[model samples]
Target: MNSEIFSREIIVPQSAIDARGHVNNLVYLEWCLEVAEAHWETKANTDLKKKFAWYVLHHSIDYKASVFEGEQLKVETWIANYKGAKCERLYKIIRLTDQKIIIEAKTDWCLVNANTLRPSKITEEISTLFV
Candidate 1:
């Protein structure tokens, strides 16, 4: 398995909160996606996949603590592993104050030929970059 850690700051907006008044558990996944997208754009230097062109095959997450509205959070993600068409990424949300872990997440994605809409072998550039 290979991994890359990425860091970015995010604000927990009011709309991101649940009825319980903290961040909606599901919103954490959005955080991971944002971080991963930036990492990919930086490494791949492209966003042709940005629209609806590229998609995630799977997403997994674990919320460790409540992330409240107005809090500044750190989103950290890694390209954890890949095999054939599948690539797995992991994420963690940290509170800046005490460095507390707010969440853990993982996502699996596939690189596809935009025109064909079928899974394509990860490009050698990506494989080498991830390595």
Candidate 2:
């Protein structure tokens, strides 16, 4: 596992399927957040978590292909870049069975003071953890 890139595998769930028999678009967004949160929580120390939090500023996703229930997927994420209080994280959801990228996305996030809930500059300490 590359320290900079976080990945996890999951089977498409029935609840994520829509009437079209494919995973709903919104579910992709959910997966993005889930993976990002897991990466942060796993890497950050207790004091880091208590001092800082992240909030999504924007999400941009591309649906490359549809996936059905029970299809296995490999979700991967990495920080692309950071500036001031914000950073962009990139995602790729791949169909593991076929090795095809089903979804591609990027999310802009803002770092905030956990107590004040106001934007805070992303220091080298915080940015280096993900990059």
Candidate 3:
């Protein structure tokens, strides 16, 4: 994999917030999924339409600011590295209200065979495009 930025606009909702009155940690991950899926389907147009499956192997996040509901934000993600069948991606959540960074995350994902559920390589068509 390689580092290339992809951006998506997001609208935060009440459900995305925690009792502390800010966006929850897990909700940032949900944004990652939303933006990443769009990046894959609309931009890359890869194996997502077929019956391929992607599973998160690991995730790490660092919170820098309090993000509240009803806010417009931009999420940026990019491939950071890869090995075998695993790809590492980095994410940044920036609040448009103030251009302040609210969160950052790193995710490790692996493609799995839809039928066998065993690890599988991302199709060459997909991998080649990330390079």
Worst 10 residues of 2 by lDDT: 1-10
In terms of lDDT, the best-performing candidate is 2
What's every prediction's RMSD, in angstroms? 2.5, 2.0, 2.1
Worst 10 residues of 3 by lDDT: 42-51
Report residue 9 deviation for candidate 1 (angstroms): 0.7
Clashing pairs in 3: none
Candidate 1, residues 1-131, lDDT tens digits: the string is 55557789987899999999999877888778888888877666455454223469888787788978899999998777777777888888999988999888888898777777788777666766645
Local accuracy of candidate 2 as per-residue lDDT tens digits, 1-131: 12388999999999999999999999999999999999999889999999999999999999999999999999999998888999889999999988999999999999999999999998988877875
Residue 51 miss distance in model 3 (angstroms): 5.3
* lDDT of candidate model 1 versus the reference: 0.79
Q: Which clashing pairs does model 1 show?
A: none
Q: List residue ranges in candidate 2 displaced over 4 A.
A: 1-3
> TM per model?
0.87, 0.96, 0.85
lDDT of each: 0.79, 0.93, 0.81
